[model samples]
Target: MKIFSNPNISKVMKIYEKSKKHTSEGVKETDYSKDKLELSNNAKELQIALKAYKNLPEIREEKVKEIKDRIQQGSYNVAGKEIAEKILQGVQIDKKI
Candidate 1:
């Protein structure tokens, strides 16, 4: 009668069905000539952008040096426009939004 009392019998049945399927059909191995990777159409662009962003040493190192210099000077103010732009682009959000 309680919520947890039944303990997801349907889920248990699903697991049992999958086990039977695995026994009948056996398991298939994946081809790893390309790391066996797949991404959703929505996320595929994000993956590419992330890879490109990581390749930007100047963008990364300049910000690092900017922070270090600001720390030594006892003042730090970030120029966040570029980062905000990148994040917006990554998420495919329009600048007008």
Candidate 2:
């Protein structure tokens, strides 16, 4: 119960100083307007993505069985180059973003 007896004093003070520096650097109260705009944009983006996914193709149960059957029959082929090309395209697109 003595002052300065706690060894955590220096640790707490160091953390506090760091946080204070960050606040002085640029921290400000949250802006509801900008936050709401960003959230709405995110929701719109997610909805668009979901719609795109649904529109892409129906590659389920029947497709899975077909692929499995083909593979078991030793005729299942994969175009690795196409996959690599698509991946590279994605990377390029991300860089543009």
Candidate 3:
């Protein structure tokens, strides 16, 4: 094995040593405290909205009772055009998905 005395190798070694010293000197001991979480105004509002939505009834009893009453009284009337439009709207939504 043979080692050559190159000026470039010496220059690189010097730079590496300088950087090593700087790295060691620049580091300091760090003290970490407890982690904290904070929500923004929008996030707080969204949480409140979500809570409210969760609390809401899945089925509206009053509306259902009114519809049932109308149906029993034979007063419930639905237009064919309205039903067809709703069907077409459902088809459009399905196509989009």
Judging by lDDT against the true structure, name the best candidate.
3
- Model 1 RMSD vs true structure: 15.8
Best by TM-score: 3
Residue lDDT tens for model 3, 20-50: 9888877755456899999899999999999
Per-residue lDDT of 32 in model 2: 48
Per-residue accuracy of model 1 over 1-93 as CA lDDT, tens digit each: 665357697678779999998877654554346557777987988989999988877566878888899899989765699889888797786
The 10-residue segment with the lowest total lDDT in model 2: 29-38
lDDT (CA) per prediction: 0.78, 0.85, 0.91
TM-scores of the candidates in the order shown: 0.27, 0.31, 0.53
Cα error, candidate 3, residue 53 (Å):
0.6
The predicted structure with the larger lDDT, 1 or 2, is 2
Evaluate model 2: give its TM-score.
0.31
Worst 10 residues of 3 by lDDT: 1-10
Better of 1 and 2 by TM-score: 2
Instruction: List RMSD in Å for every model shown.
Output: 15.8, 13.6, 4.9
What stretches of model 1 exceed 4 Å from their correct place?
1-47, 77-97
Per-residue lDDT of 1-64 in model 2, one digit per residue for the tens?
A: 7656787987898899999988876746544454343458889999999999988767678889
